[model samples]
Target: MPNKNTHYKVKNLHGTSKDRYSKKKCECDNWLAHWRNNTKSQRTTCAVLECARKATVGAHVICVDGRMSNEWYIVPFCKYHNHYEKKDEYFLDSRVHLIPVYKLDGCKRG
Candidate 1:
């Protein structure tokens, strides 16, 4: 059995075209800076309904429609949901609920 105290680390997807990391700076450093410098309280639970585990990461939801106006929504998520939530195949045997993000608000568009 997995220890409850074990913290999960998000790994950069291998052999993929996505740039999960930056060559100029550490992604974790940037995330930590954002995580620490913020005055708002961090979310303590996964945003998925009924999930009670602590949110270990901020999962960004990309806008699927062009009409939505290029927006990236970020939500608190646990390791399991954050990992499989984006993979469409996970829905084949599961009823996953996706929360939509509509505006960037204070965040900048890249």
Candidate 2:
């Protein structure tokens, strides 16, 4: 768990990959499931700070601070907030767990 005062800067990377990784699969079936499994917790609200909407999808985002920029992370997001048009960077709640998309990052169940 993260401290309540902490926040992580992240940028939505949806639609940026041209669907290249759309077919990629993890042991948990979907990115949202992967996130839930890895985090060991369930979220009812969006991960974006100040957003109280219900979370409906696992959004792909990248850390904007250059920490593991090449890696993609999964965060819970509402349908409206998950769209590509909302490209502005936002701060995620510190308690939200970022699940890695890659299987080798320990998202695999074996």
Candidate 3:
């Protein structure tokens, strides 16, 4: 959980610039800095309705057995859009999500 102070700092930054670390993406663009550079491991874009560009990894996509829940879930969001979107979704550090759930451990993603 983020404290009020942290939230204030982020808000201040985001209010001024589109930097997620600086906290101003809604004003600029949703993708964060250093994203194209992090592609060596696991990195990708937002899984929302019609978003473009690459989002940063926030969680490892996971799903527990037989439960319509995000128990083992993850949230795929850039530092910017993560704070903005998710109509009906969950994600993880890898920053990816697919509806109706997929076998994350069952499949491999970059």
The CA lDDT of each predicted structure is: 0.38, 0.77, 0.33
Candidate 1 structure, TM-score to reference: 0.41
7-95: candidate 1 lDDT, tens digit per residue: 22222222221355222122323332233223144446665545677767655544332324333434455677667425521111122
Q: On residues 51-96, what C-alpha lDDT tens digit does candidate 2 reach at each position? A: 9999987888988765555688888988888887888888888788
How accurate locally is residue 58 in candidate 3, as Cα lDDT from 0 to 100? 36
User: How does each model score on TM-score?
Assistant: 0.41, 0.80, 0.29
Model 2 RMSD to the real structure? Answer: 3.7
The residue-by-residue lDDT of candidate 3 on 1-110, one tens digit each, is 42322221111011323333333212312222222222323445654324564656433233432234443233344555545333333322223332222232322233
Residue-pair clashes per candidate, as listed? Answer: 0, 0, 18
2 versus 3: better TM-score goes to: 2
The prediction achieving the highest TM-score against the true structure is: 2
For model 2, state the Cα shift of residue 40 in Å: 1.0
Which candidate gets the maximum lDDT versus the true structure? 2
Regions of candidate 1 where Cα sits further than 4 Å from its true position: 1-39, 63-70, 84-110
Question: How do these models rank on TM-score, best leading?
Answer: 2, 1, 3
